[model samples]
Structures are given as structure tokens and as C-alpha cells.
Target: MNSPMFTRTSQQESAIQTNKVLRNTYALLSMTLLWSALVAGVSMAMNLPRPNIIIMLVGFYGLLFLTEKNRNNSMGLVFTFLFTGFLGYTTGPLIGAYVSADMGDLVVTALGGTALSFLAASAYALTTKRDLSMLGGLMLSLFVVLVVGMVASIFFQSPVLSLALSSLFIVFSTMAILMTTQGIIRGGETNYISATITLYVSIYNLFISLLSILGIMNDD
Candidate 1:
């Protein structure tokens, strides 16, 4: 049964509303990226070190957790954007490498492709009637796999493993978007604002990972 919070008069109307959530999610995702880009530029200009970056991520996540824990307060969006900016600043290292002219085009291409792919996948999940709840378990399991793969990568250093992981990364990223969108449909995600922010962050990280894959594949 659909939660009355997100239920509509009919299935058609319910789908329409779900699409609205997706649309809102996409809109916020773009703005979040823009904010992140601006922060990246600043971090690079300031020559932030790895420790500083790590601190920023830790602090940013801490604040996000704190604010989200108190989300009933009026400062939720403020906290969200603040944490997003910090996340972008922390992302400086990944993007700072591409500050050179050579990888710029590839980065843009990868980012665009990732965004489009995520959008399409989320849209499919929204428009279709398929149940994606199973993906939740897959999402959790992927993290364990991802962590184990990272540990194994240190010793193996095999290109095959990296390639396989890249493929799995893309698959899991798409599934993240799919599950989030379906959560909206099933009334599993109650807070639209938080849902949109969570989805936006997932897609942003997906873009980063996709760019890394593309850059490595091209040996650039």
C-alpha cells in the first residue's frame, strides 16, 4: 500500500507526482554541481592539501549528520547547501588533477554523460511500474564489495580487476538512482528535500567515478 503522504488519486497521477519528484531532484542536482564546481576552483586556487581535504569531508559530513538529525528545524536547506559546498571543496583533489588543459574536455564529457545516464535511469524507474526494492539490498552489498575490492586492489594491481570494478561501479550508481526514485514512488522517502539532496550527492559521486573510469580507459 502506498503511504498516504505520497499517494494520489490514481496510478497515472501517482506516476506524474513521482516524475515531479525526479524533476525536482534533477534541478537540485544541477545547482549542487554548480556549487561544487565553484568550491573546487577555490580549493585548487588555495592549494588545499590532502589532510585539509579530508578534514573538510569529515567536518562536512559531521555537520550534515547533525543538521539532518535536526531536520525539523528551519535551517535544513541551509545546512544541506553548506554541506554540499564543503563536499565540493573536498572534491577539489579529484578535479584539481584535471586543472590542466589536457583532461578538461574528457572531464566535461564524462560528467555530461554520467548526468544524462543517471537522469535516464531515474526516469525509467519513475515511469515504469517495476518494483526496485530489491535494489536496496544490492546497494548495501555493493558497498561491502566496493570496500573489499579497494583493499584487494592494493595488492593485486591488476587492470582486469579495475576494469571489472569500473563496470560494477556504473551498475551500482545507476541502481542508486533507480532505488531512490522508486523510494519516492513507494512513499519510502518521506522528506522530498532530503530525498532530492541524497539522490543529488549519489549522482555527483557517480559522475566523479565515471570520469575516473573514462580518464583511465583513455590512458589520459
Candidate 2:
């Protein structure tokens, strides 16, 4: 059996490691977000055509898989930026559409909302010691439902259903932020790269969903 001092020292070391991971994750996440924004801005200025849905889906999932598979190495960081840049590029057409429609203000508003929501969720998770692990299963279920709803709405094209799905995605994204933050604090997520990717994707979805709702509401 270990002495009390040994156990105490081990705990302290673990705490330090967790803090380092958290700090690195946040640092990388900020840089990736800025990089993504820059790419999106360039894409918008070029007025690039949006990739087809099939192409978008393939690129997203393929890059995401590569990122996760390499999360322990430098390649993870490379793939993370690639995946995020791809996503940002894909969003450029939507931004162009909103600007063309003279609804640019709505994009700003949605971005503000997404940022505020993320801060709130992250703060609560950090300040509270509550174990958010229980939320994992529930979040997974909600995610599946959200995906099904999104796919169905694509086919049915009902405004009410689409709005409801957007609302659901907002909730899912907020909970995901909370869960991801808590996972890091609890040391369940040891890899900062994976954590950054998860949080980035959540924020990305949150912004897109909010923008969709705003666009629908402002439709003339």
C-alpha cells in the first residue's frame, strides 16, 4: 500500500496534468477558431460555390475520422485545422446568401448568441463540481434524434419542423459544451486535441443552428 504522502503527491500531479491539458485545449481551440474564420472570410470574398451535400458530408466525416485517429500526435493538430477549415469553407456560401439577402445583421446576432451560450455552459460546468458523465447517454440519444429530425426535415421541408429541429440542436449543442468541459475537468479526456475538436464542432453546430433559426424567422 502507498503512504499518505505518496497518494497526496500523485493526486497533485494528476491535477497539474489536467490543468495543462485544459489550457492547451483552450489555446489550440482559439487559434483554430480564428484560422477557421479567416478561411471562411476568404471563401466568402471569393463567392465560392458550396459543395454538394454529399461532398460536404464525405469531407467532414473523412477529416474528422483522421483527426480522431491521430489525436495523440502532431498529425492530430494538422487534421483538426483541415477539418475546421473545410467546415468554415462550407459555411461561406451560407454567409454569402445571408449577406446577399440583406440579412447580414442576423448572422452577427446568431454568432453573438452562440458565443454567449458557450460561455455560460462552460462556466457552469467549471464552477460546479457536479458529475456530467450521466449526461453522456442522454446527450447521445438527443444527438441521434436530432440527426433523424434533420434528415427528415430535409425531405419534408416543413418550416415548423425545421424550426423545432434547430431549437433541439441548440439544446444539444449547449449540453455538449457542458459535457465536454466537464469531461476535461474530471480527467476523463486526457487528450487536448480530441477535446478541442469536440468543443469546436459543438460550437460550429450551435452557430449554424442559431443562424438557421434567425433566417427562418426573418424570411420575408
Candidate 3:
């Protein structure tokens, strides 16, 4: 009998399909990341300052959200890449400052750690096929708290508060990794694009949080 869901394909064919999806995801991810770095470099060359951070950050989020919501088409990929590039430009000042600092190399270290952690999380999720949908609400709440905390900190400007937030973000990002990993494993076949975006965000935010922590510790 023919299945309504997926056709009964041979193991080799299934493997080929899975590999193709993964390959496209990785290729797009890598290309976008490279473009992001290039954009950051070009922005710096144009003498863009960090004080313009708010506009860049807000714009990136706003546009990315809108773009990603409609990201199933070609335009979605274009916006995703553009959003990533803007994010790189926004983060470049921080990256530059971090490198200029005495312990700036910590950024690179955090990046390596984040990469390893992301890989491990994804691999585990793919193998286990466990559902992590439970984390959706929790993750949403965490982000809300972080956003509120940041707004409050504008007036507070307490280094201690900043440290606490950085630490919390680092922890929360790690948790997000788990949720995304599980989703990737359980639903990888159904929506590879969404899964790829989810995984990319998890890794990117993890690196940012780790960078925050490293930069903070260096400041102290």
C-alpha cells in the first residue's frame, strides 16, 4: 500500500535526500556568514561608529523577523542573508573593541566553544529524535526578561547588573541550544529551512552571549 505521508523510498535514496538538505543548509549558512563578515569590515571602513548601535540592532530584528516569517521563498533567503550582514555590521564595533583589549582573544575562544557546543547539540538532537517543544514558552519568557533587563539597564548602568545579564544570557543561550537541537532531530525532515534557521540563531546567540561574558570578565 502507498503511504499518504512519504513514499517508500530505498535507504540509499533516503540518505541522499537527507544529505542534500543538510548540504544546502550548511552551504547557505556558510555563505551568509562570510557575507556578514565582509559587511562588517566594509562598515568599519566607512567609519561607522558604535553609537549608532540601536538603529542597527532594531532594524536587524525588525527586518529579520518580517523576512524570516516569509522566508520559505527566494526573497526569504535574501532577507536572511541581509539580516545576518546587518547583524555583523552592528557587532563589528564590539568585535574590534574586544580584539583591541588585553584579553580580546577570549572572543575567539568563546567562538570556538560555541561552535563545539552547537555541533554537539545538533548531533545529539539528530540522533535522539526527542521533542523539545516544551521549551518554546520558556525560551520566549527568557527573551522577554532579557529585553526588559536591557531597557532598565540603560538608566541603571550598573556594571553588576550588566554582568548578571551577561551570565544569564549565556546560560539561557545554552538552554535554547537544547530546544533547537531537539526540534531539529524530531522535525528535520518536515522543515529543513526552519530547522536550519533555528540552529543558526542558536549558535550565533550563543557566541554573542559568550563574547559578552568574556568581554565583561576582561573589563574586570
Top lDDT: which candidate number?
Answer: 2
Best by TM-score: 2
Model 2: worst 10 consecutive residues (lDDT sum): 211-220
Q: Tens-digit lDDT track for model 3 on 1-220?
A: 7564456465556667666666676677777778877887776666566656578668867876866686678777877776777777776777776666655578779879888877776676567645666767887898899999988898998878887887777667766767655543333444455555665666677778788777677674
Pick by TM-score: 1 or 3, better one: 3
Alpha carbon lDDT of residue 3, candidate 1?
Answer: 73
Quote the positional error of residue 213 for candidate 1 in Å.
0.8
Candidate 1 deviant stretches above 4 angstroms: 1-27, 45-47, 50-57, 153-163
* Angstrom error at residue 160, model 3: 2.5
* Candidate 2 local lDDT, residue 158: 88
lDDT of 3 at 35: 83
Report how far off residue 161 is in candidate 1 (Å). Answer: 4.5
TM-score of candidate 3 versus the correct structure, residues matched by position: 0.80
Question: Candidate 3 lDDT (Cα, whole model)?
Answer: 0.70
Query: Which regions of candidate 3 deviate over 4 angstroms?
Result: 1-20, 44-47, 51-53, 188-193
- Screening candidate 1 with a backbone cut-off below 3 angstroms (N, C-alpha, C), the clashing residue pairs are none
Off by over 4 Å in 2: none
